[model samples]
Target: MLKEFTIQTPSEGFVTITKQVAQIVEQCHGEKRLCHVFVPHTTAGVTINENADPDVVKDMLLALNHMVPDLAYQHGEGNSPAHVKASLVGSSVSVPIVNGTLYLGTWQGIYFCEFDGPRQRKFCVNIL
Candidate 1:
């Protein structure tokens, strides 16, 4: 099964979409399956990381900026850093669905990593 949802992001940051994914998993009729969450955007991506502390997200963004500063890119759009960050973060995440629940770690959650946003984005969830 497949489902899609939209999210509005800030200039750059992480948005937790774990709950939305869990809701979709729950609707799969309590089957044990694998869920693939995909973000089909060049400047955005998805990942699994710590959700209990905001500092982790902040540190990750800081590190990415340091590694791929916006002003240091050859791309004319000036958003090459976003593309690099998205590539590093990846565009999809797979989680195990068991008994209608997502089998994520206690402190781990799914995140939409928006490197250059302030725009509307969509992610698709595929259950198999």
Candidate 2:
């Protein structure tokens, strides 16, 4: 099954979407399944990471900003850093679903990564 979800993001930040994905996964009727989440924007992506503490998200964004600092770039859009960040984060993530539950670590969760935003975004989740 495939579903689309719309979300609003800050100019740059991570939005946790674990519960949303789990809600969909909960509907699946099998014990063995896989959930694929994808963001279809060049400047956005998806990932799974520590979710127990909010600081982890902050630290990640900070590290990314430091690692891909803005500088002179040939990209006309001037979002070269966003593009690079998105590439580093990737556009999709897959989570194993077992016994109708997301098989993530206790502190792991799904997140929508917005490198350049303060706008609406869409992500799709496919369960199989």
Say which candidate scores most in lDDT: 2
Task: Supply the TM-score for candidate 1.
Answer: 0.95
Q: TM-scores across all candidates? A: 0.95, 0.98
Error of 2 at 82 (Å): 0.4
Q: 8-86 in candidate 2: lDDT tens per residue?
A: 9999999999999999999887699999999999999999999999999999999999999879999998899999999
lDDT of 1: 0.93
Residue 122, candidate 2: alpha-carbon lDDT: 97
The 0-to-1 C-alpha lDDT of every candidate, in the order given, reads 0.93, 0.94
- Off by more than 4 A, model 1: none
Best by TM-score: 2
Q: What value does the lDDT take at residue 27 in candidate 1?
A: 87
Per-residue alpha-carbon lDDT of candidate 1 for residues 1-128, written as tens digits (9 for 90 to 100): 89999999999999999999998998887668899999999999999999999999999999998988657567898889899999999999999987789999999999999999899999999998
